[model samples]
Target: MADSQRTSEPTNFVHQDEIWKAHVKVEKDLAKVWPNKWGFLTETYKEYERESLKLKEEARMKLPHHLAARPPTPPEKNIHVSRSPSVPQTTQAFIGWRSAHSHLQLEKYGTVHHGRRSFLKELGWPLDACS
Candidate 1:
């Protein structure tokens, strides 16, 4: 039966030489359809790069001389102070001294800052506690 013949087909029928010849044939067919494919792509990319460079040069030339020469100024720093009716000055000064580690008391706080970690645990570095 045809079903029996299909079931008994040899598994090792494919040869490396036949596969290589088929590959060569496919490449030849592609070459006939599109000759110098890689060369055409390279030329198109080069043309695009050339046009981009030309446009950049033209844009640079159009900018005003003073705008191009001078650098932008940095933003001004503003300090804010708040006055409260009930809170004593000494209490606020003590809190500032504790946070800054400085002897002089600060009236207006700029930013609450943290010091660098002295131990591995503070910096989140892993340590073997069992050993």
Candidate 2:
């Protein structure tokens, strides 16, 4: 009766048992090593942070003259006047140019559906719905 019941079970049941056993073994192995690995990674990351901050401080100290000599520039009086009118003109021209260029490209290369239809034809696939 047990033999008959085992034989009645799907082949995948046996495969699933093997897969589950392998998964359990892997989990057990990871559990054994995980704490040591986690400790090593944490220590290494902390060391890296300390070294990086030390190097940044050294670089900053070496550049004291460069940092002090460059005074911050005062804002220009005509900055707002210069930006207000030219910005809109420049933006409008750019938009117009981009629109015309994309239209030209669409006419030259066709759309994504056309490309897919050509690819399917190359693969000798049926295009009943594609048309």
Candidate 3:
């Protein structure tokens, strides 16, 4: 019984009108600050046009025609987790190659001269993972 009765909420009559006026005022201020030159107006930028066109076209082409997507197959459970002796040796070799004193460090093997990616890839790591 106590919650049965309710009163109407008070409203501001000029609230919405004031908001529109503020927006118009801001727009006019912006126009004065960054106005068109010689009556020519441009809302968009130029460099972004060329840069975005390729990405936009690629995105447009990638859209699938069908709505249903095929679910991925479950992974195998009994995957082997073995490594060869040479793999560890290669990994240690790779680590030694990147250090400041790498030349002195791996001097036991004469010289460990190799590219950063190639040295790591020789140890069973993917070549493209770094990039």
Candidate 4:
């Protein structure tokens, strides 16, 4: 896909602009790693990717157009997630724009009820649904 076209496309409805934003975030994060061997997000990052793929799959099958603009279909309740080294899982934490629940873990301490929201807000997630 052309760079411009790719930028214009939505990964899905619920997550439209993140694919590119994440790349930029990583590039900036990597610059701070200072020659570290494991600079990239490892298990959590991989899990994020896998989860993103799953969402994409579901979108293609259940809601293609919705995927392009699908708001989170939360399970009618707030959920708290614990972090894991394995595949990333999602949390119902609605912190802010910096968060991507598609495949992320909870805070290490789990102190915050909505870690995703805080993390995302720090990352610049919009304040809209992030209460």
Candidate 5:
């Protein structure tokens, strides 16, 4: 079944983090919209609160001892994102840090592939791979 297949997919850690971050965002939005005729608490908000707490508890237990001892910190701001000035401002395209790093690798290594061995092999500039 489609449902079963969807559930079988492994949950990504980043996706989980995003879900937790969304819960906090929802709470903030609720607070800001409270007491306004147009802004009312919805059933979705209640569901988010319940789910977030359950996920948090599970995560805490799974955390390493040192991390568990310290209070959890808020999600980090996305500072690693790179902006491409060559593209037109009106167009929407996000060039991440990985893309920029890949560009640097290409320039330095000349068509070097990704991975540990390939990276180090490229560093042997004057000598080619022997045997």
Candidate 6:
């Protein structure tokens, strides 16, 4: 009977109301323990941010007059221009290349033998009776 029960498919032992009651109880317990748990963490983060901003302001004030007066220059944008004209330019050709790449990747890595059963089989465990 114990072995049969172990092998059988699991059934819903707890009803909807029971699950709801349990959830509500857990929430109530959490509220009792620490109602402002998330609020405390947020307040701590805000304090840290305030300190960081204050430090940044102090650093800016300490900078040399010439460096502080000068306007910040925009970063240069890196534009990539493909030199090869024979490379796939059309959408269809690009898609075909992508598909081929994916197929090659699958061929290199994909395998059928996997999961817990496979692992057990590799370790010389007889899983035929269990299944």
After aligning candidate 1 to the native by TM-score, how far in Å is the CA of 109 from where it should be? 5.4
Give the worst 10-residue stretch by lDDT in candidate 4: 92-101
Across 28-111, the per-residue lDDT of candidate 1 in tens digits comes to 999886745556887889999999999999999999987696765555435443443343358656554443533233634665
Task: Give the residue spans of candidate 1 off by over 4 A.
Answer: 1-10, 13-17, 28-33, 36-42, 65-131
Q: Superposing all C-alpha atoms, what RMSD in Å does each candidate have to the true structure?
A: 19.3, 16.4, 21.0, 31.0, 23.6, 17.4
Candidate 3: list runs displaced more than 4 Å. 1-7, 36-131
RMSD of 1: 19.3
lDDT of candidate model 1 versus the reference: 0.68
lDDT of 2 by residue, 62-105 (tens): 88675656765667743332212232346657664533544333
Please give, for residues 1-131, the per-residue lDDT of candidate 6 as tens digits. Answer: 88898768665667767998999999999988784666688778999999999999999989988776765555544533333334587877876564455433435466566563576677887777466
Judged by lDDT relative to the true structure, which candidate is superior, 1 or 4?
A: 1
lDDT of 4 by residue, 1-131 (tens): 58988877655854547777888999998878854766455767889999999998976778556446667779746766556443434553434323455355345456666545566677887767565
Compared with the true structure, what per-residue lDDT tens digits does model 3 show for residues 18-117? 9989999999988787755523334355556766998999877887867446676556654443332333346657653534354334364776666545
By descending lDDT, how would the candidates be arranged? 2, 6, 1, 5, 4, 3
Best by TM-score: 2
Tens digit of per-residue lDDT, candidate 5, span 1-131: 89999998887999899999999999999978785744446666888899999999999889988765666565565334344336434434444433555643336456657664654456865444553
Colliding pairs, model 3: none
TM-score of each: 0.34, 0.36, 0.22, 0.19, 0.23, 0.34
Worst-scoring 10-residue span by lDDT in model 5: 89-98
Q: Which residue pairs clash in candidate 5?
A: none
Stretches of model 6 off by over 4 angstroms after superposition: 1-10, 13-20, 31-33, 36-41, 65-131
Error of 1 at 44 (Å): 3.9
Prediction 2 TM-score vs. true? 0.36
